[model samples]
Target: MILVTGGTGLVGAHLLYRLASEDREIRAIYRTHSSLHKVLEVFTYYTTTEKAEHLFKKIEWLEADIIDIPQLFLVFPKITEVYHCAALVSFSPRDYRKLRKVNIEGTANVVNLCIDFKVKKLCFVSSIATLGKPISDKKMITEQLNWNPETNHSDYAITKYGAEMEVWRASQEGIKTLIVNPGIIIGPGFWNKASGQLFTRIHHGLNYHFPKVTGFVGVNDVIDAMLKLMNSDNFNDRYILVSENSSFKDVMKYTANSLEKPEPKKDLQKWMIATGWIFQKIGSIFGFKRSITKSDINGLFATSYYDNSKIKSAINFNFTPIEDVIEETGHLFLKDNAK
Candidate 1:
């Protein structure tokens, strides 16, 4: 039996659809009843309504939180394989404690349960944000790069790196583990959060585009790589699952064109970002919500590249082009909004 955490999330929902289509005996955990709608919506993206409903019924849904050890303990029984995908993604400084609790402590709870249950295999979904900055000699961040604690990291990155440490400890204790650090994952659904918000912001005529470059991959590629790695003999190793390194300007332009929306015209100069961060910081003192942070300024302007050769060589894998990924996701975005 397989157990999946965060099964209602963008990656988990899509993964559940694939696993159900293959007729796998799967159990998934969700925090809320409303989130189940997301899973069905994702299934219908690839199949008929009846088929999607049927596939949705195949999952043994359980309400659990990873941070609650007793609740998480009940989830691990009879689960031979596990997919750890539940995570709190936040960049706000106010969420630092929450991020640490959920991403780091919550992952620790999951790892403990996996050990207690003697699970056969574990797959963890991590982000490239945990990867260290590329050094002067090495232009691309790879699995070989060691994290430097001295370097400033966002609260979200810090917790995820800590989570990776727990997963590494699990491998030492005899659990076969596979960790995948994916770049900005692009997919349809959940427009209010994460990468899905990129489509929303672009469609609503975002006027500024930053020049920072980072790795990107379609959601399907992420799922494909995870499934292949878990089913294979690969374990106790990490893979970077990036398809291409692209600038936000190009990505936004492509998304705009796909959505038939006005392309962002401003270059979003660093000075402008700095000025906005200053005002946002000042506004925070007066109890106003902060939409921008100090770390966000650096992230928006930094040009960091990721190397994918390791995963490609490890699995003989090929990635879908980002342009095609944006085109398809944009089509779906338009279709959903048309309703």
Candidate 2:
């Protein structure tokens, strides 16, 4: 039997679909009732509604939070493979505590449970943000670079790095582990969260574009690489799962073209970023969700790139072009929203 945490999330939902399609007996953990609907929603993206419903029925859904150790342990019986995908991604300073609680402490609990249960293999989904900053302007970040403490890292990054440490410790305790540092995952479901927000902003006619370059991968590609790695001989190692290094301007333009929206004509200057953060900070006091923050602003202007050669070499994989991903995802986004 397989146990997958965060089965309702972007990655976890897709993972569940693949596992269940293979007729694997799997238990998926979710924290809320609404998330069950989300898993079904994600499955429909890849298959017909009828087939998706069939695959969805195969999963044994369990309500559990990774941070709650006692609740987590209740679902671990008869589990051999573990996939830890629950995480909190936030750039706001106000979310610092929640970020640590979910990404760091939650992951610690998962690692402890994996060790205690003597799980055969643990696959952890982490972000590239946990990696160190670029050493030079022209060099792409690889698995070899050491994290520099002097750099200005976001609280989210710090917490993910801490979570990676916990996974590494679990590996030391004799668990066969694999970690994947995925780039921005663009997909069909949960358009309100993370990379899906890019599609939403584009559809709503966003008029500002940043000049930063970062790595991006399709959601399916991420899940594909993850499953391949877990089933392969790859163990106790981390792989960077990036399809391409694209600029925000190009990404937004492609997204706009796909959604048939107007592309952003003006570039966001550094001062504009600073002022926007100030206004967002003020909006937070009135209970408005802040979109951009100081750390996000920094990320917006940074030209961080990643080399995905390691994962490619490991699995002999080829990634879908970002343009193709954006076009397909945009169509799906429109379809889902039209209802």
| Candidate that would win on lDDT | 1
Could you tell me the TM-score of candidate 2? 0.95
For candidate 2, the per-residue lDDT at 114 reads 84
> Which residue pairs does candidate 1 place in steric collision?
none
Instruction: Give a tens-digit lDDT track for model 2, residues 139-241.
Output: 9899878777788888788889989999999999999999999998888897878778778867876777778888999989998998899889999999999
**Tens-digit lDDT track of model 1 for 190-238:** 7877778778877876777777789999999999999999999999999
User: What would the TM-scores of all predictions be?
Assistant: 0.95, 0.95
Clashes of 2: 0
Report the lDDT of model 1 for residue 74. 84
Residue 266 shift from truth in candidate 1, angstroms: 0.9
